[model samples]
Target: MADGCRRRIVLPREPHAELAAVPLVDLLGERLGFSRDTLAEIKLALVEACLNALEYGQGEVEVEVVAHADAPARLEITVTDHGAGFDVSIVPQPDLTAKLHASRKRGWGIELMRHLMDEVEVHSTPGLTRVRLVRKRKEA
Candidate 1:
């Protein structure tokens, strides 16, 4: 609806559950004036976060989106889950140069999220994990 408004969605933990990101991204793109390319990036990142929650979380996954009311508006999205969390520092960097067959497919989500979003924050504990993504609205 209005700028600075927030919306939240809670999803079950299941295969392909990340599909919920589609409508959320569409709404954000329309309301916040996100470019096609930016929307694509946001969608991908949101899916990754959701997938992680579906795969590893112990309870329902929560996605929250906030549209800021600032001079240069911004959007903040967060994906949270109650699960057995891991230390983010331990995740090794992905070898982008490696061939698809040679590289492991397990650890690229965090890296991709960081590359796509202007800011990424991850907080984890024994029972909770939260991934936050932020991007600034493009000025016309």
Candidate 2:
């Protein structure tokens, strides 16, 4: 597929908690022709990023999705916020083999986001934080 197939989106800085998120998620899924299950996972991942932005981001938030409908079946999405960003290193990794009862509250978002996506990338400075996520399409 041509690079023209790539898709991207940007949300205004500090979007409303309950508004604007679902539509963005839907648009991303529709653009990629993702399966129902994949769509759900992507939607949740997008929402998680937005929620984190609302909680910690200050100015504006930007999100981008790029789709390549070929061999790898891939989707690339990036979320950016102009707020104080965290050091990605500190988030704890979940021990799946352990019981799920001892869950902690604060850092689960990063953990889940990383697990759900095939690739996770973070770029942050004092006032800007950007996260890139990728999910490969199913093989034909």
In terms of lDDT, the best-performing candidate is: 1
Worst 10 residues of 2 by lDDT: 12-21
- Residue-level lDDT tens digits of model 2 in 106-131: 55677778878888888888899988
For model 1, name the residue pairs that clash.
Answer: none
TM-scores, in order shown? 0.88, 0.76
Residue 16, model 2, lDDT: 66
Clash totals for all candidate models: 0, 3
Cα lDDT, model 2, residue 115 = 74
Candidate 1 positional error at 104, Å: 3.3
Predicted candidate 1 versus true structure: per-residue lDDT over 20-75, tens digit per residue:
75677777666777888888888888888888888888878899988775657777
Alpha-carbon shift of residue 126 in model 2 (angstroms): 1.1
Name the regions of candidate 1 deviating beyond 4 angstroms: 1-4, 97-103
How many backbone collisions does model 1 have?
Answer: 0
As for candidate 2, its clashing pairs are 7-65, 13-60, 73-137
